[model samples]
Target: MNTGKVTLLSAGPGDLDLLTIRAAKALAAADVVLLDDLANPGIVSLAPRARVIRVGKRGGCKSTPQAFIQRLMQRYASKGLHVVRVKGGDALLFGRAGEELAALRRAAIPVEIVNGISSGFAAAASLGVSLTHREHCQGVTFITAHLQDHGEPDWAALAATGTTLAIYMGMSRIESICAGLMTTLPASTAAAVVQWAGTADERRLVTTLGRLADEANAAGLGSPAVILVGNAIGEAEAFTVRGFGRAASEGLAHAA
Candidate 1:
């Protein structure tokens, strides 16, 4: 009997357009799809004949167990069903793809990974800036503010790297994250937040490290957001015009 395979397909933030052609083709051929919380719901249409299962894993909310999701994938694939695990953003980027991959491998199930744009990149695009601006930073660093131990990351050490910081699952502890980074980064260091990046409801806020938390709070920004820090964020076209000044900050509270 021919064994089925599992395809770990990245959904690319919340934009259907950002979904890669290969991902779409995989979806079309899928017999079962495990959809993630952050992926666009419209993608279900791509797999019209496939059974879609929502195994959402949003922070601060009830989530489907990882073990159960893995078991479902294994069970289906073992029955010669083409299982597609659809994840938001790049599956390899904090999407628990590593654990799923390991589980599939141990089960001897054939697997393939289809890469897609991450939310960090979408956030950068929303701000119209390059994360690795030659004059500003050497490269980019993607880190999650949420750790398995619920402990904090070495913000000071990360700051010392001099790379653009793209922080995920950070809005809930924006203040502390900023405070940790402030140990090495100056208060005037540019910071920005992009909520629901790559979607129609996307909102952007540009400010300094000192004001990021407060500004984000004032703007009613919450989770499902990406926090960006470094000189590169200052290069955004709207940075100077929408940030810095008290008047502009006040306006941004309502506008952004």
Candidate 2:
């Protein structure tokens, strides 16, 4: 018998090869694939028999609204179609999967989750950096600059324990975050932004807290990116990462 359900699937960061075998199977069996911009299209192509729906919500671009996306999932599932909502990274993180889960539940549709690799891990791997460096950061926090006019986040808290902070979708708010961190993190504190992370055209800006914002802006590092702030970022400046700020920490060590 056909099932009416929506699977909130994670397509991983960018590399299609990172997809899990089960996720690959789901994609193959999906009757409709609702994919976000961050989720690679090549991965979805595996589900050639399914309807491909590009619901990429790029910042400042024409996007299918969140409500609309949820409604589509529910509507499609009601028709006994297997809907696979492909999200980049993990669906439970900043992907706003809760809302869709609620919508599906209210409609009494079956739902499942297929986890995927996250951008934080992918970006860190591409740069050979660790979010939990034993000598520096002990924990990691994943957040997003998800506001239009929201004030700066609490730098004192973010800087207090030296935990790694991985930000997604914060290109526009980079200035505010950097400025806040500079107050306590020092100008030399390692900081970086990875653009097109885990992809062939990936780029990394290796700079200190003070220059992180300027370098990112100057480089035009826009959406579909990740920002990491912490001493662990020192690894990103390594030549192997093809970084831009080779000497970004020259004077900050003395300041710290």
Instruction: Highest TM-score: give the candidate number.
Output: 1
What stretches of model 2 exceed 4 Å from their correct place? 238-256
TM-score of each: 0.94, 0.89
Question: Per the 3 Å backbone cut-off, how many clashing residue pairs does candidate 1 have?
Answer: 0
Error of 1 at 204 (Å): 0.6
**Candidate 2 whole-model C-alpha lDDT, 0 to 1:** 0.81
Candidate 1's residue-wise lDDT over 20-64, tens digit each? 999999999999999998999999999987999999988878999
Q: Encode model 2's per-residue lDDT on 155-200: one tens digit a residue.
A: 7687876798898888888888887777778888888888777776
